[model samples]
Target chain A: MNTKIENKLTPVRIIAFIFVALWLVIAMFPFIWTLWGSFKVQADFFSKADWLNAIFGFHTEKQTGGFFTMDGYYGSWIEEEFWRAVINTSIVVFFTVLISLTFGTLGGYALARSTYRYAFWILMAGLIFRAMPHMTLISGYLQPFFAWNVWGILPTTIIVLVAINQPFTLWMLHSFFLNIPKDLDESAMCDGCNRFQAFRYVIIPIMWPGVITTGLFSFLLAYNDFTVTSMLLSDENETMIPAIASFLGTVQEEGKVMYAVAAVVSATAPLFFFVLFFQRQIVSGLTAGAVKG
Target chain B: MKHSTFLLFSLPSLSVMFLFIAIPIVSVFIQSLHIEHKQVIIVTENCDPFGCETTTAVDTEASAKLKEKAPLGKFNGFKTYSNRMHFAFDEVGEAWKSSDSFTVFTKKLYNYPLYRALSFTLTYTFVVTPFVLFLGFLVAVGVNNLPKMFKGPTIFASLLPMIVTPLVGSLILFWMVDGDGVIGATLQKIFNDNSLSLKASPVLTWIMLMVYGIWHLMPFSFIVFYAGLQTVPQETIEAATIDGASKFQRIRHVVIPHLMPLAIFITLILLMDNFRVFEPIIGFRAEAHATSISWLIWNHLRESAYPLYNAAGATSMVTIFGVAILLLPVLIRTWRDFKEKNKG
Candidate 1:
């Protein structure tokens, strides 16, 4: 690649390195700070007297008799019953991703294969749905959900997330499906298989790469969600994000802000490992739509 | 695939979408035209030692019975849309008649919740979109120049902000910017004003939220643009260099044009996302200073019983209309592109 030679300009190369290094600090310092502070007491982390107390754990040592402490984590996980929220989030994310991918692959396959103009209209409608704010959709569901007595539960939230996620999932998978040669499935259909057989046997196997990528995004949407789950789910069915929000409401009055801090860090740890393992797939998924166009 | 087969394949998704997405929009419209039911009142006569007294008491059972029968409340016929909380016809009319200067009138207009939220949403969308585009392009260019060994780690670190939950990410930064937190404390010492608070000042609050937005969003654009950069035609770059073009000139003339389509793609996404702008307001506790359309709907329904469903529905409908308008340009452009491709 000529990019190898393109950076030969010494001054420009140095400038670019400095700029990127500066950006690296801005992007990472908060995460590093939070992850470290989650172990310390509130006084050390939020020390007004001296900021360096956080690094040295001056107040933390005085209060907890150790340089590092797990009081925040213990408070969030045990005292606050955050494990219930974690279990809820796991159930929600697992089902939401499963259903979204199943629906997305099928619908996206149809959209990708069809030559009819109506397929274009379907995608256009999906585009509009994709752009509509999730809150607006939540407002729509509240009254009917209330009347139906399905307003707050894990299953209802999962299905709603699946439906809300469908448009974006459809769009992404449609692009990925387009790249998979149409010839592959058509030939399978010609040989002996019916359409469903051809899809199940031929397309499904090769589609895992795209499906996995799409599934990760679905996981992120379902996991990162606050608007839908917060409004829709009852307190007993609280997911991680909403649970962290509630912790802020109650814990602040009792001088237990560190519980919220620990909960946030706890929720973020899985996402960190997720990105580490699937960084390439995530990047590919983000660029898929752009590259197609 | 045959027509029957196509139907079988698309059936599950189509049905779920129609039931969940399509029906609810119609329901939101119906809900917007109605108000919550008033408590049923019944007059009862009670005998006391002195005299018989008449009292009107709320009939709780009858009200619950009425609500069960007609849960959407009483039909108000667009009164909610015109109320002070929403479009605010009477308030706007009063402001229109009372203010002398156009500036004062404009100031008075945003005092309404709808306009107040709209102003912040539009400003945030317009401001953050451009900054993200510029900074993303900068990072993409910068990262592209770095040594190969450093590239992977750089990208991994960059993805942290964007990949984390938006609410959690904002909370992380919000704690740090609290009056006694690290950045907040440092700034206080530097300015010699211990009383300084980022949350207290509306301007600083807006800037901080936008900064958080940019921090969370820039990575998406950066990664997209980074991918776009790899495809820039090296021959053209070499040709530009042979023609005595400087690095900046080469980038301006060559790299930018090559990535223009990706830029457009990023812009469409950025606009859609920035317009919502909900979580950070809640996460930063900045509702007093800023609100978006999404935040407005959330506010109305945030109460225990969602008694303000009419207000929430009206705002949701208006927001859906806003999204439609926002999407119009992209749709037209895509339609033209499709038509051109078909004609050929």
Candidate 2:
């Protein structure tokens, strides 16, 4: 009846679109603020604080002539402590994912391929780790490790991450393994392949998607972990979050301008990093592999 | 043969879980039962009535000052639990002008120990769980129905808050919620004309927590629900539409019904998460408002004047067990539903 209707642009649809669009913006507010803060120059940030206050409902006052720079972002990135944290986080995440994936995927496959009487209990136990709070464990369960002279921060972080992340990976990977029909594994076994070979030749390729998703989930969690990192890590070697946190606090102490700048920088970098790579996987993997599993 | 292989394969995960999760919970269980005198309080009455302030000498309780310092030797079985329950139920009756006149009640309405902690915990879970789930469900539906291009971006944007450390989020929120900060200053200007002190109002004490908490929780619900929504079969919705059903009808009848399993799962997860909420409470209160159970636990552990750390830990275990028992019925129902649905 109407050209607009034919064009799939009805009033109802437009209103719905606008409503969703607003929601989306509100959802992205923290990230946007972080990004904006990251690029603002020190003096401009200070002067703009008042304006930002009015605009963002904070104590932002406008500077006479506001200009943007990348000083804070670059400074945070270049700091030796920041770099060490980056390196440490990377190393820890790598090992944690590797170890968790190997054991979780292997166990998941076993549960999928066979029907051990106690398989249900093991599956449920793995879930308990996923459900338990990391913070509670850090103070109680991890106290013994802190008491020990042998295990260092990096090792301890890895161990904790691996232990915590294992159950999630197991739950996820088990579903993945389950999706790959058992007839394939059985056929391989019939063809003179041992359990290991059958797993390697037949099941591994099929379950690769699940494995990748589990690894991705584990990696992200390990990389961004704050609780375990906070409890286990000392001030000498900072992680990404604590580094940003220190910057935010220091700026807060000095001036609100610097605080805004640090907030923007720290917030934007991780967000873009996540959006650029993990966005699709995070959603799809979460939907198919994470929730159900 | 496959069964044995499966058992062999499961052993590594089983061993790690047992050594880590099971053992620690057991140790915490054990720790809660045995109480030791970790705190020493100075009693003034015996020393001097005239110079009461300077007269008191600190001494440990005979029951608590044991050398072994193990839970087993410190208190009898169930003794620690009973004492904890007593402390939870019995609070110091009322402060008196003279310390000697005040009697810490043996049968208080609620003890400062577990009663306060439990109250905070139950309130936290009750408030957050329902709100998070409801908001999460709505946001998930909204996001799920978005155009393909916006879907990915929306998911990422929503999830960013969730991925950030709770402590960091708390700190940021703390700055914003402080009297001189953004939220306070803005509300002061707009509604009250620079008159409102958001923090000073007892009613508004937990407001920052509820508002800031949404930022963390919305993403979790969104992600979980989004995942769940993906599994809702298109045909079911189409069939409802073919019957001249409205969008609301289709969603209510078909979509929500399809998401029952997911709803159950997410409910359980969020229930657990809400129960343990700690960081924001700590960040918001900074040791002022008795906010949530985790904060209460931290308070007890951190109080230099009173070393009630064991008591706090014990109370936490009790809370944990209570939660497990509470959720057990829902979990059982969900499992049964899942099984019945799967079979059908």
Candidate 3:
């Protein structure tokens, strides 16, 4: 009986394992392609021998130089334009999350705690904004959003992102705030802790998980958002998505055949890093529950 | 103890939000109506070698000029609308008999491209949204029911799709479905045929899109469904099991009912979004057979397609109205539900 059970279970396990392994490969194709292409030299970029020979499951020696190198990746790392975008993306993402989470949490708490007359209206308004089409908003403000400024167009872009993210963050944070029990607040109040103190001391500590959840979601939303950011930030020295897009545009304009490699590499770099950093949070977020709330 | 301090703490965030989002949204509505009225100035005597027609105001000086030379004209509000009418519609019955290159009604206010786009938008939204929710639910349920060790890792692994930028996602899909990519090459080799392009062929293009769309969106559904599952009352499940209900029965009857509200919520959001799909279409236009409503608007707005703009805008407006119409009932129900939750 035991042997029969073992034999049956083993095949199921193997099949499940293989299914997961294939999914991982499919999911990470962009990252894999980027890593491979980012390291190649200019000359070897179009070598049919490089891509074709590998396709046929055969190995061929390079004619002059090789397929992989540290040069391009390292070159891009030190490239002033790439670094400036890296700094710009990071700053915008960080501040947007910080500002949105602080307000979202407070506003969420107010809505969650209050049994007031207009609480439902407040929540509905938040939901409507959350569901509003981003294109509608951006199209309306295209010129003004990117108006050239002395401090550079970076601040305006960041503000645009913050607005885009706030509605969703508010909705997510409100659910988390409601999950934290009301008794904890009442007890803290009885103990002479004021509302702010209760929020800071009692409620926030328990709501840490919710805060982190909303914060990470906000970061990803801001980080990967392309159209709004692309339209809102026209300056070359501003951020990653538009910078890479313009690079692709210029490559096409120059009539270069080897531009595909750069396009693949620049696009997948952030995705690779995101997978590495927030793997845990992302997993939980995915499997947590439905969005009915 | 300190109500003033609480108010002060809340004010900053509210003001910032109002400044960035609320104010700008209102401004956009105002700016959409730019320069409602204008004047066209035509000079006959001083006309240079180059054709130069300037649009100024039809004021006192222009009125005197108009009396002297009737050729110098000024067109008004409905005049522009009338001029654009011929481009707006083709009356098929009359054109079929006349055969004069399909003379359209210049006085007509209808924008045909926008009309076509609205129907397409509704179709796209209605189709894509539900599938996303269903697939997401299945994946989430599958992941949740796994052994605890696999649960954590599987959830993280799925995030790969969500983490990648859609621009990059479109790029990767573009390559994979192209002639030289691994999947396409493998398909060609396996089938013993050379003519296999995953994205270029009309039938295959749709298959590629559906697959890519599912891959891009499944993770979002999985997360939300998973979170919803976490709230499932464990004791009730245990009671059902004790009463000899099959695992499938428990899920179908108890769990699905529990998840209904969430499914409805997700469906509304996804429906709104999928109807407005544009990014992937723009990225992979060479391969995609599908052209969404937003893409139609953008394509028309390009300088090459300049004459098509008013029609496209009209189409977009119609689409916006269509979505509102479809979602209006659900919006009302959700509002009532939210109010009841607060009340009860």
Query: After aligning candidate 3 to the native by TM-score, how far in Å is the CA of A210 from where it should be?
Result: 2.5
Query: Which residue ranges in model 1 land beyond 4 Å of their true spot?
Result: A1-9, B43-54, B304-306
Deviation of model 2 at A27, angstroms: 1.0
- Residues B228-305 of candidate 2 have per-residue lDDT tens digits of 787788888778888999878988898888777777776777777777777666445433544566655555554447
Candidate 1 C-alpha lDDT tens digits along B247-328:
8999999999999999999999999999999999989999899999999999898854645888989999998898888899
Candidate 3 CAPRI grade: acceptable
> Tens-digit lDDT track for model 2 on A1-293?
53443346545456556766776766676555545544554443222225363334232223323345545545655642356667776688789888898888888788776665466656665655566665455435433564465234677677777877878878787777777777887898899999989888887777766777678788777776666675566665556665554565465566544543464345436645865686767666767743553
User: Candidate 1 residues A142-191, lDDT tens each?
Assistant: 87787789988999999999999999999999888998999998999889
iRMS, candidate 2, in Å: value is 3.5
TM-score per candidate, in order?
0.97, 0.80, 0.77
Model 3 iRMS:
4.2
Residue B64 in model 1: lDDT:
98
RMSD of 3: 6.7
CAPRI band for model 1: medium
Error of 2 at A193 (Å): 0.8
lDDT of each: 0.92, 0.63, 0.60
Better of 1 and 2 by TM-score: 1
CAPRI tier for the interface of model 2: acceptable
Model 3 lDDT per residue over A114-226, tens place: 66555556566656666555655554454344343422466666776777777676667766667777898989999998888888898877887878877888888777776
